[model samples]
Target: MSDTITLLYAQSVIWLVVFGLCAVIALMFRRVRAFYRRIAPLGALAPTAATIAHLPTTFLRSFSGSEVTAGGSREDGRPQLLVFVSGSCPVSRKMVPIVDDFARRERLSLLYCGDESDEAQKRTIATLGLSESGFVNDAAIGRLLGVDRVPFAVLLDPTGTVQARGLVNNLEHLESLLGVQETGYRSLQGFMTANPRALTG
Candidate 1:
């Protein structure tokens, strides 16, 4: 009986040591992955958004089905921010106020994009109080921009150049578009490539 108890105790200690080692390894691995993600190019981690360098030259339609000439210098000479959303998406609905606030704060001309039906789009426009000048309910724009997901955003300079474009689910993501613009790089990957010091910083 004494020998059996000692063996059981030893086995338990061995298992505990193994579990502890695994926990330490998991923690270290997570830290390393996080560090890598910070240093890696923006799109390299998990594709949060497409790397569209410039706004494709194309004509866009408003939610009211009116022709709107896009891809040229803005009349107001301010940057434009296009947010892709779906009227049916709960997250999109949640983002309406946040996006509005961000656009107003950033001095950006905010535009909303979606691929929902016209009736649904109309309802969404009315429900959200979106300006006709700032609403687009077309799939063509999403195709042109290579947007594979909803809740994506593209920031354009006054000259119609893409300053930054990415998937924005929260304020941090929305704000990163501005941060990317400040770096003077059209994309975060380009910024990291040119500014290697950012890794350590």
Candidate 2:
């Protein structure tokens, strides 16, 4: 009887250990699931207020009467970067030098889009030290590009597909568009969410 009780007690202990291990495993799974939920990819990059990505953009002509296509066939086959700005906007003025440098470094076909008067636009171009050839005088172009704010930027692929578009007030914001293009992520948030391990590991 004592042996029987000992055997039963040992069985009970084994079962208890098994249950405890199962509970521990379950808790670990729950924690892992919670972590994944916290880092889940977001759709914030696909904002309703902005133009959709991967869509062909409309073409526009520069003030110089040269065809400045955004997302269509061009003889150069180079990617285009369009920056919408206003001559009177202080933020736009501040970004001019940065945009100019970026364009030169990236070898992108840069175009400055603004609704300012011809003289004001010319002055802004000269002050910014950008090529007059890169200035497109059409406010309607902004509407077509779905730009609602000044200092907005759009990066188009060689095929004229909108690769990235956002409000760029500083160098980081502008560079993030290139990051999105190269990483195949829509936004910085999307990148962090998809690669949570990159942050922790």
Candidate 3:
């Protein structure tokens, strides 16, 4: 009868809506998987294989006009996190705030260094809204740590000993660098290799 037809039509409409929602979810999942796969390769390039060595003592000046001694013990009594960046690098520019946030969260004295020209450096400082402190424009700082790449990071203990150094392209890479302090491994890959339990645990 007419009543039965009405009920069947309503059911058909409900099933169509459910199918549409499912299809949308599946499409979104595929996009997420594709994005993850693209970034996975970039993450694999981090935590360089070269042995990290102690940095030589060097004197530098901060953007805030403070005399800073880098790569050596300081009276501050805190670990140092050195981030080697370039004014011209898009990745470095995009990471300024992120690096600052990470450093603050980790309670590490952070220093930003680059070899770009004075103009470019100033532009980065202004564009990134970096407070006129904790930024070093000296090229020597990077050279002292044998940092031949931009967007590199080095974590040094309070005594100025290098704990970890790596090329960081994402937050995950930065987290793994800090993990070195606990696992005594240069990279998470090394840690997983030495401790298979890392995979499950």
lDDT score for candidate 3 against the true structure: 0.75
Candidate 3: 10-residue stretch with minimal lDDT: 39-48
Runs in model 1 lying further than 4 Å from the true structure:
1-52, 126-129, 189-201
Query: Considering TM-score, which of the candidate structures 1 and 2 is the better prediction for this target?
Result: 1
lDDT of 3 by residue, 1-201 (tens): 999999999999999999999999999999988767654222213334543367656778888899877667767778888888876788887777788889889888888887778788898777666765778888766766667787898888777888777788778777767768786865556655787664333
Poorest 10 consecutive residues by lDDT, candidate 1? 40-49
TM-score against native, each model:
0.66, 0.62, 0.67
lDDT of each: 0.75, 0.74, 0.75
Per-residue lDDT, model 2, residue 78, is: 80
Q: Residue 25: error of model 1 in Å?
A: 25
Q: Which regions of candidate 3 deviate over 4 angstroms?
A: 1-52, 188-201
- How many angstroms is residue 126 displaced in model 1 relative to the true structure, after the best TM-score fit? 4.7
Model 2, residue 66: C-alpha shift (Å): 3.1
Compared with the true structure, what per-residue lDDT tens digits does model 2 show for residues 92-118? 879988988887888888878877788
Query: Which candidate ranks first by TM-score, i.e. highest?
Result: 3
